[model samples]
Target: MPLADAGLTAWSWNPLTDIQVMWSYPFMVNAFRAGAVIAVLSAAVGWFVVLRRQTFAAHTLAVVGFPGASGAVLVGVASGYGYFAFCLAAAVVIAMLPGAGQGHGEESALIGTVQAFLLACGFLFVALYKGFLGGVDALLFGSFLGIGDGQVVLLAVVAVVVLAVLAAVGRPLLFASVDPSVAAARALPVRALSVVFLVLLGAATAEASQITGSLLVFALLVMPPATAQLLSPRAAVSLPLGMLIGLAVTWLGLTAAYYSPYPVGFFVTTFAFAAYVLARAARTAATAFGARGPRPGTGATGGTPHAVEEAAA
Candidate 1:
């Protein structure tokens, strides 16, 4: 698989031909499949992560996967097991910290402490590895060259299970996110929901790291959802819109990386950041235009002012 040879010297004018050439390799096929699965899972869980204001916790979980992968390599096992095990364990540990009911300042402090510790452990594991570790660049940034059938299947199965669990708890979770005090007054299990969501977020973060690497997983996890929220406030629209944005960026990144000599993470992050900037500009323009429009009950028809309209009402 001359994926290293830059099989595609130049993109043709024909879109179909370009796509056909790109998809000819089995590795490319697996890369696309794995990227799609990770994007969907990350975007879905990321919406909640943003809504619950748990981006700090999400960042901690993402970093936790690095040490997990490194430790797995040290112990002579598949990295996927280490990714899930360490991330889930870290999530549970974060949830069980003593600052549950206290302010976010304390919880965030504890989460940051854990993140720092795990990162140091990752460096230690890397130092302990006696082998050449040729794939260290891929571990930190990203590479789409080595995705396989088994990895694709594993990603798909994990995405299905995580999304299903999210769907099961969607409403109560939303209620709790919006107003935890009110939800608790109604007998909802706020704490339990928080723990479950963190675990799921951990799982999603770990899986996403397989393609984007632990450092750049936020390209999928945060950017798309943040851009979607800027476009629309409604969850029904923004949630799936975020997924679509993530999937688009992933496919675009894979395609770009295949033709260029750069890492996939760079392309993915660049594309997502571009989309967010565009969305922000559009929102700003709309706000400015709306402010300049005619006020309520005072249009070109010589309508009464808002005060007059209210008086008549």
Candidate 2:
């Protein structure tokens, strides 16, 4: 059989079989694996991020790690692991900062300063390590096609850990996120939990930044959860739904990028943006329909009958 004929036959087979055939192409397989892992981890952490309004913090950490990782690469180190360590350290330090309160204007300013400094440093390191220019570019823009099995395995572990942590503290996290005042009144260890969650989120962000790059990491981490929240108001349903949507985005984006000329980040971010738009539209439609309800004192049995007699008298 001609190679093209065999390829068509494989494509027409079961989805799993089709995926396996595609995996035979090394870059395609690695890209799909990397995208899937990052999506899961992102959705899991992102739920809390949206709930607590810490999306900016997540973005800052990812950006800060870019330069740190580049510096490590310049010094002949494991850039990926080094970046993860640096991000975690930064998370701890941020958590400990006296005036670095959450969701505040000042906090954003501090994060912006850190991000700018790190990015500048990253550029310097990249210039210093000219021999690894291709690798640095891959780190900055991400190339799903070039991911290796080891990176895939590492992402898988991180995804699993993130899910487990989210599950273990899912309820309290939500409680703390939406109503910290009430949570604190109930003695929920709001401060400590916030710090711990930030650390875990930092780790996940570092892992995700490896594939999506710091610039687009928020698309994977924030968009899905935000979209899910629009689709479902309940936290329980929204969390799982967000994961499902995230997985779909990753898988579909990877497959689409496999055939398209665009980069993986473009496809991933596009998929997320489309999801967000759709979710917003759905929410608006639902609100429009739900608003067509009976007005106060306008229903047949809602008003006082005696008031009519009193007015007549």
Which candidate achieves the best TM-score against the true structure?
Answer: 1
Question: Candidate 2: lDDT of 112?
Answer: 67
Q: Taking the tens digit of each residue's C-alpha lDDT, what string does model 2 give over 1-313?
A: 1233434433454777767766787766777777777887888899888888888778778887888788877888766776688778888987887646364664677666767888888888998988776666666765565467887787788778877877888788888888999999999999888888888888888877776776788778899999887766666667777878888988876665554555667777898899898766655554454345432223221122222222222
Could you tell me which residue pairs clash in candidate 2?
none
lDDT of 2 at 109: 70
User: What overall lDDT goes with each candidate model?
Assistant: 0.80, 0.73
Give one digit per residue, the lDDT tens place, for model 1 in 116-210. Answer: 88888977887788763666666667778767898889889999999999999999999999999999999999999998998999899888888
Off by over 4 Å in 2: 1-21, 99-110, 134-136, 293-313
TM-score of each: 0.87, 0.83
Candidate 2 positional error at 153, Å? 2.2
Clashing pairs in 1: none
Show where candidate 1 strays beyond 4 Å.
Answer: 1-9, 98-113, 292-313
